[model samples]
Target: MAGATPLRVLIGKVGLDGHDRGVKLIARALRDAGIEVIYTGLHQTPEQIVASAIQEDVRAIGLSIHSAAHKTLFPRVLELLKAQGAEDIVVFGGGIIPDEDIPILHAQGVRRIFTPGTPMQEIVDFVKGLGQ
Candidate 1:
């Protein structure tokens, strides 16, 4: 999120995903691209992430879950966002997610999904494009 409104973005790690190099790279890239990023380091429950997102008033949420819990973690995030009345917020994720599960993720309101080898510009542009 950028421009005059400066859509806030919450970059979070859900489940037990400890590998965060990719998360840091995306966060840094967003910051460099002039998007304000709120990085939630590691080991975040979906509830906590959503609560913070509502409190911070972010326009989009980018989750970086590398663990196998994407199946479980993804829906909970959507549920909570719906509960918080922020369902309009754009949600997406990146990590070691399987292609089969991606449609399910999107169906649950995940706007984008980037895998390990996906280009960095894609992530930045996708997130930035939300404002458009």
Candidate 2:
């Protein structure tokens, strides 16, 4: 592991949503899978998320939103990332998002959206596959 580079991911909770249980689970799971996870805690703004992603130089961002703000917040994060020239950083998320909104989020540059009951290994494999 000395010379090999591990894939890094930023796990964030944006907007006013305070429920962090799921995000914490993901952070731990990703860490256990050998991915470096930078958890930004709760109530993070889109700007703050992008800034941290830029600073951490992560390969991806996994946001957990349960406040139904994904429609607005996710796109804002993507826009800010693009404006900051960090567009290459993959943006994905998981939460109580409705199925109808997934396509819009994808169009806004969110690479993936995992709903409740998604297997942990699937999330792990998704991020790992990004390296390939």
Candidate 3:
């Protein structure tokens, strides 16, 4: 993990969802944790997000999805990463998601899902623990 830069994170708001409160919070939390965080604002396409992640060379990609596009968006992001040979980058998601959808996401190669009320500390710990 040399030159890790304290675990960089790309926090993005994907799809047509204009709501970005959650992602903003995550970005601030990551920044406060001394990790480099890039906030991609709102209404980002999957391609834009992946491209940003690759450019930033972030260790993880955090998708803040409050819309009903996780099932579609999540897998698409994975596909984009695979296509670009960036499949090793850790994928994380936050915001509202059904309980039944968690396993499917993990099976689809998403490593972490942070639901509502997930503390900033937990998110920080989760990302840090991933490097272990």
**Number of the top-ranking candidate, with lDDT as the measure:** 2
TM-score of 3: 0.95
Candidate 2 segments exceeding 4 Å error = 1-3
* Tens-digit per-residue lDDT, 50-117, candidate 3: 99999998888999888888999999999999999999899999878998999999999999898999
Cα lDDT computed for each candidate against the true fold: 0.88, 0.93, 0.89
Error of 1 at 57 (Å): 0.6
Clashes of each: 0, 0, 0
Model 1 quality (TM-score): 0.94
lDDT of 2 by residue, 67-98 (tens): 99999999999999989988999999999999
Q: Which residues of candidate 1, in runs, are more than 4 Å off?
A: 1-3
Output the worst ten-in-a-row residue range by lDDT, candidate 2: 1-10
62 Cα displacement, candidate 2 (Å): 0.5
Pick the winner on TM-score between candidates 2 and 3: 2
Query: TM-scores for all candidates?
Result: 0.94, 0.96, 0.95
How do the residues 106-131 of candidate 1 rate in per-residue lDDT, one tens digit apiece? 88778888998988888889888887
Sequence-dependent TM-score of model 2: 0.96
Q: How does residue 110 of candidate 1 score in lDDT?
A: 86
Clashing pairs in 3: none
RMSD of each: 1.5, 1.8, 1.2
